[model samples]
Target: MKLLLILTALVAALAMPTSAMAAAFVVDDPVDGPGVGDPTDCDGGAPPGNCSLRDAIAAANASPEAANSITFQITALSLTAGPLLLTKPNTVIGQERNTTITWAAGAGPALTLEPTLTGTGSTLRRLVFVRTGGGAAGDPILRIQADGTFFDRGQLRNGPGDGAEVTSVAPATTDNVTFAGSTITGNARNGVRGATGARNLAITNTIFFGNGLKPISLEGAANAGAGAPVGLRVGPRQPDGSLPLSGTATTGGTIELYRGNPFSSASPTLGDSFGVGAGAFSRVPPFALAPGEPLATTLTTGGAGTSEFVLVSVPDDIVSPGLTSVRAINTTQLRMRLSEPIDPATVQAGNFSVEMASRPRAIRSVSVDGGGTEILITTAGGWLEGEAGYLQIGAPGSFADAAGNASLVAGRVRVAAGPGDFTPPRLSNVSVTPKKFCPSGVKRCRGPRGTKVTFTTNEEGRLELAAFKGRKQVGNRSFTKDKAGTYTIKFSGKLRAGRLSAGRYKLRFTMEDEVGNISPAATRTIRALGRKRR
Candidate 1:
């Protein structure tokens, strides 16, 4: 009977929605107590208003209501005293219609988080953190020690040195801590700093208007360990720092692009662009940009800003070069699928080829799916049918910038088909056409004569060519394929004849497959026939 009763309770617990298990807690009371020494405000005696933020944190830690709550709202509380420390898991929302934390001539920080106490759940929202004190050593304003989750929203500004900040002798031991929807400006040092194990830390939608150092700085660990996987994610504020109207994915989630407006919403258009370094950018899927789908976010100009968007999405059919997919068939062969189909005439080894825009040299052969819309491109020559492959697809403009404009917005991919008997070879055939300077076959023609050199392939894709003029470089071109899966490339902008001395120019064209497979150099000998001078 006891076992039966336990099973009944377990079933009941599973029936409850996750929301019922996790709920947000808000602190709006303004009762003020004594200034530390006074017995009246010693324990919980002080009125809510007089009670310092530290005292409130202690009270929340001891409160049974704080555990299951998602957020702790701290309305208008002053930090006139020293630093306010936290060592638990809870969000403190400040900056409501009333109240704030002030810094009148204090030598310490407005908020300080030490190493010993881990802030499992702690946040400072809607509060004004000021540093009116003088001197270079004027409190860091906000010092976050090792370990814990801290969500510091609201406004963090006007400190002698760095504004509301996170400091540690070594990197902290905390894992999931973040700074969002806050304005950190006019400080001496960097606005944010992450060391040793501040793994998975994020600073989003917060403005670093001005600072002596960069707005954000991260020194990742050199090696990897259980608690030491390293990376830092940052982005400007969204329109408003609140939940989206349509119930979008909340901030602080996996998928970086989903966290910010993919369309560069805050700084939308061509001029307002943000650039990520090769290190950070490399960590993301090469084709991170989504074209058509609501990839662009609308910025809210008024109060605070919030960024809430989805990153990984349902597979959709969108036609754009950027929308690409990859299917890895073991280590021998791979296949790539596209949103739209391409012509079979464009698939090949050297002449014209299609390859992954991210790592162009990573693929071997290209073939359009029997239907055209699907492409069967491979990297491993040994792949066979029935084998599975990895797929990575992106939207238009997601592939090449030279094609100029992009068409699709979002893209999707799945391991559709693999090596089975259907697996195809990486190369079909290679061909090259040489342009004759004197089409008339005349030994000599006009001066400064021009010629057209074209390379055509059955597969539709991109090609990289190296042209040599008798071992000397004539020029090189990276060609993009058209919809028909054919790359009809022309190398122009050259004066192969005229005033130049008469001589035989040996031009060699070497074609290569996406998988770094190269075709023997197809050599073409051209005699720069000269004409009599007037």
Candidate 2:
């Protein structure tokens, strides 16, 4: 029976069509390159540092020619990125509203997801597409020619053309496109339009506002005979925001909509501990990550032979920590309140992004108060009182609860700046101690305290540290510096992953004054030696 089962599995595997084996590409650089590196290796070629989105996509598109069904683990990406093409299925997955794809006037559509030879579509998550300078653009934000394209948790906003529309006006065989949990607003033309020959286009859990002409127009233009959309499915607004097919009827011509997006509910084990006190925290941020290290090594001294209250995350616990509120304490500083205790070491620029008027603000440093309930962030530029903006957190699945359960979903909060001094604190002579870190079992990379964080501030404020290994935020540690001078504190950042790959990490620091005025930012780089030696 076991042999028969094995043979059945083998037959199923043999019957599967030959597509490109799965691959992950970490796009570290912000610049565009053809990605001359080997498709299988993705080493940034003989000259490294040029392998970014284009390069990764180029390599990913070329992967079907290779032998091994390589599941490449890409670990990093750019934070200001652009118009590109995807020939493969579901090539890039960005956090909703957390990842922005901008297109220049001359560049084609911000992105084009072309279907495969067999006519299968792609799925993209949590991405925002827009035009530069907010003027008339020729192409739609996204041009989907595939048959079953599914895009969730994205925003098609502020464009000169349609927010999301068909690839062609004459309909070159595009249909079965679905858009969910997205915002289509402030565009010059229709929010979502369909051209002739399109069929079964659907959108749900979406918002259509301030768009020109019509919110949704499915018919083909007058001149293009029979170019109108064959059918349009507008689903009902989900109460909890789950994407269940509501079986709504199709309306052929044009439809105006002011529908709203859905919000996810809490997991069964999830509960909020609002207004938590600082004394509840028993251990440093890094030690709490439930990486399954020996409890003896990580067990904090709470009681009876090393604390039974081990401040470690339970592996695989599905608690979704949520951001309850985000408000600026001052022009340069913002504080976030959370439902669960977040691991401080994982709070960094790589995990959070700030956007004002569709542009990102440079993050200097982030501070998590001792209890992990409140997060303080210091951004580079200051804003006036009541300036509108947003904060996108945990986009790369970085921040976690005390039980080590990573926040798989990204969340965003609308924020308005508070009144305070616009000038940020001055920072200088920042440094990280000579130490390296790898995962728990890996002996090749080891150094005491992981790495020490030392810096000087001009005024009384807090010392902040945010560490990132490529685009992945590894860890962060923050402490209050009442009266500032030169101070050397041990950085408790875990270079720990399920073991780590040998690579460089960016160590960022900032000084926030008592009023939350933050310095621009100081950066240092440290390397983590995984299995490979430098």
**Between which residue pairs do clashes occur in model 2?**
96-126, 196-227, 196-228, 220-228, 302-307, 313-403, 313-404, 314-403, 345-475, 345-476
- Candidate 2: misplaced stretches above 4 Å? 1-20, 33-49, 65-83, 90-92, 95-97, 104-106, 133-136, 168-172, 221-534
Tens-digit lDDT track of model 2 for 1-534 = 999999999999887767534555654544542333334335434255545556566676676632211121333332133456667654545532355555444455666777665535566766676666433464577777776777787788777778777654343556667776677776777777766544666654455567765655656431132122212222111222221111111212221121121111111111111111212121122222222221111111111011011112222333445667677766566777666567787677677888754567888988886246567888875566657689886563456665444555466778766545556778888877675655344555545435566777877888766666544455565689888688887654443233334678776777767655567767788776555466
Stretches of candidate 1 exceeding 4 Å from the true structure = 1-34, 37-49, 58-77, 88-99, 116-119, 134-138, 167-172, 220-534
Q: What TM-score does each of the candidates earn?
A: 0.36, 0.36
lDDT of each: 0.42, 0.54
What overall lDDT, based on C-alpha atoms, would model 2 receive against the true structure? 0.54
Best by TM-score: 1
Shift of residue 95 alpha carbon in model 2, Å: 5.5
Cα TM-score of candidate 2: 0.36
lDDT of 1 by residue, 190-272 (tens): 56655554454555556554556545555554111212112322211111211111212222222223323332323222112
* Candidate 1 Cα lDDT to native: 0.42
Q: After superposition, how far is residue 455 of candidate 1 from its true place, in Å?
A: 47
